[model samples]
Target: MSRLPHRASRRQFLKLGLGAGAVLGLAAAGPDILAFASDVSDFIRGPAVPDVAPTQLSEHVWMIWSKDGFPTPENQGMMSNITFVVSEKGVVMLDPGGSVQIGEMALRMIRTVTDKPVVAIFNSHYHGDHWLGNHAFEDAYGKELPIYAHPLSKREIEGVQGSMWHSMMERWTNQATAGTRIVAPNRTVEHGAELDFGDVTLRVHHYGPAHTPGDIAIQVVEDELTHVGDVAMDRRIANMDDGTYVGTFRFYDELEKNASSRIWVPGHGHPSDQVLAWNRELFEGIYGNCLKAVEDGSTMEEAREMVLADPRVAGKAADTAGFESNIGKYVSIAYLEAEREAF
Candidate 1:
């Protein structure tokens, strides 16, 4: 893997969403609920369930645990990966995983870190698993927390939220519709921004035009901890259908080359330095085969079939629900690069 250069053009990438029926709601457990909160807060073991709501991740940071976890199978995907960063000036959270219960617990944990109040939050991208928790935050902290995102992030997430809610409403009888809404980013950032917390500085890199138009990674600059969002998925396969491949791969390559930090956290999986390579390889294989199928005069449908012909990629595609959505992204991006001779 190599470090990425500046983006060549505007691009938006969205990681696949949890099937509407597979979604979970945040814990709405009454404040008096005890039992698990102490265990979760204590961090006594392996992925605590029946949690105390919020689990600590770093000194002033915590990971919100939905009692049922993410809606996806094994129920431990990105939706369970929500983490909150608290500082004296204010608190900043990244990827507030699905479930209002989890969101509220996250808020409770933020209280543990500091009494300054939550000042803001940012979504890694528009995936419902990441931003659906916004409603909980707003209800608890109000909508003025200055939700920040890329300009396109709001539109993409909102659209998905509605569509996903409808999908869930159709399946689980609105189990997925409760917290769904088109929450927008009040503050839009371009390129990068630096946020300070007493002596700690979180370096935010808007690395999208790959993961999503508004995709960004937050790094604990002093700690050398970089949260890569979905871009550098630590172990899971990278999603490329939202019209990002070349730029993502290129940017990923550049990131590999330029990033010297340690402890890379992903939107979903466990953290790792190898995430850069693992993600790049997966991206390379899928995008490569997708291009080949297209070049062979295959229709998008046929191209998708061709993708299934390759066992490695076929396995990757299995977790994703939208075939055309995936293939179309490759087609559109390839068409544009050829049009501009970006290669």
Candidate 2:
């Protein structure tokens, strides 16, 4: 069989091994069970997404906004925004997207706005939703394309984090992101590093760990706009699995002190001047109460009640995506962090 992109060939190799093991496990299973398994295998394949037009946010920055906040088969894993900067030199991509299909769709949209090729790519973090689309861009642009990320992000993406995300996205989208292979960033960018692309310049900003240890925000100096990545979301709760509330607060402070971009672009939401403020208030509402609860020796349940009752958090509950299902976990994470700080 021919080797395919997105590691479909490698996946088949692994499936063969698993298939041998399944012989024993499914020895007693009826025909119905086998039929269901066959259906699942068929569902693993997905096609390209429909072309989505890019919306211009600044003079040079354009964004292909994703309507869905979470990955679903119907949306085919196009749950993250794809932003790019057009310059005299060429185009610079910020978080290409979540999968090959989404990336291809973004490429089609890019043609509508500008004919220049994508010169460089910058990944915000290690999350698959943010960078899995690297496969598409690298394929289109060639192997020599410069994909940039923080050192830690590059390491993580080359390690288990890369494979983990690839699998997780397949599971989340029911394999709608089937053909996406791991394409880690080839170049690394650190805080304070600046890339001058003729007409526009992008400055890198990484303040410890906010969304992830490797998260890097790119600042467009000419446009007076900054792509904050997952560090701060516009109206959504950022995933804190690899992050800390304290660190997030500190990141916000450091970002404000340094980069003063008029607009902030997030990975999951629209660009806005109030992006940082909106996320800060919501985080404080959740983490502040948790810290107070820890100081008072209150239980986790009590801390959750306080967070829910917080006007800042409650007000956004109706509009926030995945709020009801994820708030409990976020509150728990905050409570644990608060406890650690108190001690």
Candidate 3:
């Protein structure tokens, strides 16, 4: 995978100042370095991530990624990719962010690129890490924005899931989530619905259930860009706690049919079809192995061992330290699902 020019430059900068000067310089930089350093720290402890920037993926499509890892106080609850599309009508945002602070940052970044108002927001899923940032938008504009999501996502945001996410925000972000509230999507979109934003048209497609029950992918019709929210990840193991392994494989097939030629912006990680394919292959292989183990009457622990024994799976675990646990969890989920289906 080719590195972005901006990311390569930041790597060079960090590499050049690896001594005492680096420490002193970072100290002088204060809060900015602390934030930047926290992002870098994800690499050593988990996955290396480039600094967030409003990078243009296509003509009018731009994205800003958050640090790689679970949301935490040090990172200010910014752990998902926030994207926006600029059209003559207005700016359309996807997954505002995880907290008010992150949302404010996204708003500032958007303003830096375009003066147009954000007319619509899309919560691709029900996860708070993707939409809790709605608080910042409402607080900033002093008006409610038209946030859209699948019916399941809207329901989850209004029920126990909403309260659970609110508690998670407070726990993970300390006081950063104080003013944050569950802002449910005002409008609901079903499968194969097209939303016209004047110059740009987004076709919303819900490819069954994958990452979450409400998972939906937005296809930018003109640009052939698809924002697949957490359905796939780049060089990282996806969370399956709220998802199903077989469902992910099904979603991958749908993505291949619809978005094979398009640029895919994931909920986390860099945008690339190769990464998407990698995730698909990972899920396919692991799920297949788990099914075989289940048919062979292996226990969950035995299925986990069999999947981990694969060189590809082992390599991924080595590359991503923090995700090692996710792999085990995924195998367990797959085994349990396969067992239930068999019975």
Please provide, for model 3 over 46-94, each residue's C-alpha lDDT reduced to its tens digit, 9 standing for 90 to 100: 1112236699999879999765657766676778889999988999988
For candidate 1, give the lDDT.
0.57
Query: What is the C-alpha lDDT profile of model 1 across 135-232, one tens digit per residue?
Result: 66787777787787666776665576545633442234223233333455677766557877886677767654887656777777766667777776
- Per residue, candidate 2 scores C-alpha lDDT tens digits across 90-170 of 999999988877888888999999999999999999998999999889989899999999999999999989878887887
In candidate 2, position 80 carries an lDDT of 88
Please list the Cα RMSD from the true structure of every candidate, rounded to 1 decimal place: 14.0, 6.6, 11.8
Best by TM-score: 2
**Superior by TM-score: candidate 1 or candidate 2:** 2
User: How many residue pairs collide in each prediction?
Assistant: 22, 0, 0
Which candidate model has the greater lDDT, 2 or 3? 2
- TM-score of every model versus the real structure: 0.65, 0.88, 0.82
The regions of model 2 sitting more than 4 angstroms off are 1-45
lDDT score of residue 277 within candidate 3 = 75
What is the full ranking by TM-score, best candidate first?
A: 2, 3, 1
- The candidate that wins on lDDT is 2
